[model samples]
Target: MKNIAIMGGTFNPIHIGHLIAAQCTSDHHLFDEIWFMPSGNPPHKEDEVIIDSAHRMEMCRLATKDHPTFRISDYELNRKGKVYSVDTFAMLQKEFPDNKYWLIIGTDSLFNLEEWYNHKKLLKIGAFVIVHRSGYDEEKSLEQQARLRECYNTSFMNVHMPQIEVSSTIIRQRVAEGKPINYYVPDAVSDYIHKHNLYQLGDDHEIR
Candidate 1:
């Protein structure tokens, strides 16, 4: 069976941190491919200002272009409204019935899995690979993993990667303040953002 991993995120602006995590996860030799799925509209981040999905998807594509095992998926982006994890997983399973999938998520998100929409069903859909970040509490992760295993019989794998201290939120803030984001994101992505003037003050426009 083909082992595929899904790395779904807002990817407001794909950064080096995201790439590092995906690469490290792939290094484990468990997955044959890793698909980066950028959400169209993230339900949890509704309060925060999000750029156009097209821009986000382009950034992801540029970031993963050089990696043979990495690919970008617009599954959620093509969907009209709020796209839930369970729905995405179900669609993928239907499309690729013969492949086994693993949902790649951060250690931070693993603790909040129970709060996600259709959480129980999502757990049973596929195994979860937790990517460890710096400064995260190891004990808390263990506790949550044990709890999920006992309650839902969910499978979890932990991957240790070099902690990248940058985030898309920070990158956006820097761009708005006219600060350089060099080395934080791929060169192609940075050029695209600059050429398009994304995240600049008063430039709130959606891609149609």
Candidate 2:
């Protein structure tokens, strides 16, 4: 069976940090492929003004185009309303029974894993891999990893990612302030943002 990993996010604008983390995890695990799944208007992010789903999807395509193993999946987008992780992974197992699936997330996401919609069922549905983020505390991440393992009786793999201090929130802020985002995102994605004038609305309204 091929080892496949799913990296799901809002990906309002796919950035280098995200790319590095995904690539690092793929290399470390020798996974057959990494699927970057961009969500529709998730309930948690509905308060913010998200760009058109097409734009988000296109940016994801541009960002991962060069990596042969990196792929973009529109499975969640095909469905209406909130598409929870549990539902997505459950479908993956049903449809792609021969392949092993892993969910990739960052240290920042680890802290809030239990709060996700039907998170317990989500944990049980597939394996998970956690990568490092720039500003999060590593010890705290390890502690949370231990806590989740004990609480859910599930295991998580860890990947060492470079400390790239970039985020979709920060990138959007820079664009709104008329600053350059040359290295924050892929050249194609950067050009797409300028050509389309996305995220100029304002700063991030992400819930803490």
Candidate 3:
């Protein structure tokens, strides 16, 4: 069975930090491929305005174009209602029964696993690879991993990743302030954002 890593997110704007974390995980675990699955309508972001799926998906494509093992999936984008990773993973497992799936989540989300819809079943879908997110306590993350392992009887591995302080929110704020996002995101992504005028005006306005 091919080992695949699923990186699910809203990706309001694909940034360097997202790529780095996925790269680090891919290198550490030798995943066959890393699928950047953009959530269409995340339950958590229901109250927040999300950019058009076409733009987000295109931005993801531009951001990971250089990586041969990286791919973008529209599975969640085509789904109806509020999107949840648990349902995504479950469907993926059924569709690709021969493949071993690994869910990639940041340390921040690691702590909030229980808050997810049917999180336990999601955990049962496959192994989880936890990557470090900037500004989170490493010790606490390790402790949480241990707790999860004991509670769920599943394998949870951590990847050693270089911390990037940049985030989608930061990039959006910078663009709103007419600042450069040169290093914050891939050049293609930066140009695309500028061309499409995305993430400006504090994410309150989404490009159609």
Candidate 4:
């Protein structure tokens, strides 16, 4: 079975750090292809800010265009309504039964995995590849680790790359302040944002 990695996120503006992480994972992990799935709508707190779904998908496409092994999937966008990890994984499992999907998530996300809708069911649909992130708790008792090992077939991928402190929220803030966001984001994305006049205001704006 072909091993595919699915990296799902809002991707307000895809940056080098994201690209580097995906590249490293694809190379080191020997993944057949890495699909960058942009979430249409996440079930975050009502106060949380999320950009438009279309823009986020476009940004993902532009950011991953150079890499042949990297592809952008608008699966969540086309699904409509609140996107849940369980539903997405279920759909993918049905369509590509011959392929083994590795849902890529950061260590930060793992801490809150239990909060996700039908998280346990989602875990059964496919294996997860959790990327190690800074300040993420690495300590785990043998008993707890054994319990997790028995609970799900998950893999921990230690991504030893430069930790980029910049986040989508920070990028948006910089844009609102008229600060340069060139290096943090891809040139194509930076140009797209300027050309399309995206995320210029402090308001929740997403450039797909």
Model 3: CA > 4 A from native: 133-139, 202-208
**Residues 1-208, model 2: lDDT tens digits:** 8888888888888899888888898787568999999888576886666777799899999999989899999888888988888888889899989988888987767788888889998876657888875677888888888887887876688898777878898988888878999989999999999998887753454322
Angstrom error at residue 95, model 3: 0.7
When summed lDDT is taken over every stretch of 10 residues in candidate 1, the lowest stretch is 199-208
- Candidate 3 differs from the real structure by a C-alpha RMSD in angstroms, to one decimal, of 2.4
Clashing pairs in 2: none
Candidate 4 TM-score over all chains jointly:
0.87
Candidates in order: C-alpha RMSD to true structure: 2.4, 3.4, 2.4, 3.0
RMSD of 4: 3.0
Clashes of 4: 5
Off by over 4 Å in 4: 141-145, 153-158, 202-208
Candidate 1 clashing pairs, residues 3+ apart or interchain:
none
Candidate 2 global CA lDDT score? 0.84
Residue 138 accuracy (lDDT) in model 4 = 60
lDDT of 3 by residue, 87-106 (tens): 87778888988987788888
TM-score per prediction, in order, is 0.93, 0.88, 0.90, 0.87
Error of 4 at 191 (Å): 0.4
What's the candidate order when arranged by decreasing TM-score? 1, 3, 2, 4
Candidate 1's C-alpha runs over 4 A off are 203-208
Give model 3's TM-score versus the native structure.
Answer: 0.90
Query: How accurate locally is residue 130 in candidate 1, as Cα lDDT from 0 to 100?
Result: 93
lDDT of 4 by residue, 1-208 (tens): 8988888777876777778778768767578899998777777734546667777778888888888799888888887778888888788879978887888777666666667898778756656666765565666422333455578754444454557787877887787778999898998899888887777653354322
How far residue 31's Cα lies from its native spot in candidate 2, in Å, is 0.9
